[model samples]
Target: MNYPFCIRCGWVLALTFASCYPGLAQTPTPARDTSFTVYSALAKARKTDPSITLARPAVPTIIRSRMNVPYCTASGRALQLDVFYPKARRQGGYPAVLLIHGGGWRSGDRSQHVPMAQQLAARGFVAVTAEYRLSTEAPYPAAVQDLKAAVRWMRANARTYRINPKQIATWGFSAGGQLAALVGTTNEETRFDSLACNIGYSSQVQAIVDVDGILAFIHPESGEGDDRKSTSAATYWFGSPKTERPDLWRQASALTYVGPHTPPTLFLNSSVDRMHAGRDDMMRQLSQFNIYHEVHTFPDAPHPFPLFNPWFSPTLDYTVAFLNKVFSRK
Candidate 1:
């Protein structure tokens, strides 16, 4: 189910880190990597205790969701972003989150994450759900580039939007999670940088939140993606399978770029999501890099569980805690 579940189309959604530290002049390259898979983590935990309690559901929070705000122009197309802003700020401008939705880089829309964004806003962050060019329009780096352009556009207009550009984060779900991870991991690498618009401003983000995104296409976890003849979404995004164009998959893999400077990251994943390719490796790399990171796994949940109820509230709680911890850092 690429589309998010609408438990309450009518239902709704803070923290303040403003005026604490100065922001960056240019997008700073952060060192970053990955570690154990959630499944492995679960196996290890259950080894200690056969029965582990499921996490409690978090209460819902609502905020004002503003839709269809134009953020950038890419390849002659206007990219739009939906913002979820906290109704009131703690003091200065609110920290921003560049929210991305997922659909295997083939199908999905910014609207899928509207509920999560609204909750984040109510929690005191200015969250924006960005639209990107899917594989249908463009492949591989195009979506990544579009997202980078969106970040720059958001930063450029931070003042008008009452957001703190310095405090911006990249948060994505599923395929969007992969893009968000790429956006965070790639940093200012010119290879992933976009010339579309807002080129002068930096797209560096302080934190990354990935919700069950596939981080590595070349990893065995994706299943049957190495064959060029197959029609997997990985091929759609890479334009070819790993067997034909290994470089493309390697270059696009978020796991490939993890370094010492990768920003603080948090992942919310399902216990059975093999779609989360390279998670074990990425987490290992992050641990090796000694970066602050965390992952919470939901037992027997679906890939799209974060967008549904029962799981929805707990997912929001996990998200709010992670973002607050990262954004509040001194």
Candidate 2:
């Protein structure tokens, strides 16, 4: 399979450097590339070389989510978000989409999702890439709480942002997908009050789009490190050993929140099975609930095919179509 050229370049550089330190004569190892990709979306996703970047869809305007606009506040730091919208205004404002980035719930920034938000904005949706606390920053439910607060913050200030609160949806990739699903399924049960921002607006989302996120984190065939208990993301993000906190682990799963009233969802997946543990079950549940849902599988694609070109167009099409249909019905 053809990979991004940037990855190939990184390998060449490493090999060249290795040859320079001939015979291991106590050569001091040069500094490692710090800003390279880590575990984003799926742990199996190949680490990207610095040059590779997501393709941006052309748009008339570029908007920032604003640096450190506290969706919620904590002793350490405040949560933030990035907003992207069309330059031309719509009559009744634009339908809002909150985008969440993936980094195995441990590492990632809202900046990674700007290209996607721009694409969505190009398609006429007011999109915001929401930031939440990482596992390193806090732990389970902290990220979830931050995301819920972000929704509330957006809805509470819909008029100022020219948003259609009734048509808001949560869209996330990989780990973010897991959070998005949680947000959609548990819309009826949980919501965090926006701190120092919107106080009373509801955090409920009308639709959801999960791009190859972990559907169930407690599966036997857990993807990353050796097993389920050892999987860095599943274990680290829970902030406990899986064996000791099975109940809490399950509670944190997106599939656990699935219920009769879960909003219409669109799931897109790569051919990889590592991250898509309980997709069939989630789909079955959605079908049984009679909720409008759709699933698409990209053949032989890697962990995050949606973020790049060639496949990005199709991915964007499915997302836009699903959002338009579901939001129109609402």
Best by TM-score: 2
Residue 171 displacement in candidate 2 (angstroms)? 0.6
Candidate 1 local lDDT, 1-330, one digit each (tens): 122111111111000101111110112122111121224334555555556433333424445666788877765768898877766655568888888887767566776667777777777888888888765555578889889888888888887667888788898888888889999998958776755588889988889988888788777786526433435666545555567678888888889889998988898897656757888889999999899999999887666666654577788888888878887883
> Which candidate number would show the highest lDDT if scored against the true structure?
1
Q: For model 1, how many clashes? A: 23
| Model 1: lDDT to the true structure | 0.71
Per-residue CA lDDT of model 2 for 165-254, tens digit only, reads: 888899998888888888888887744333445656888899999998877767764463234333355454564555666786787777
Runs of candidate 2 with Cα error greater than 4 angstroms are 1-53, 59-68, 191-197, 224-231
Model 1 misses residue 132 by how many Å? 0.4
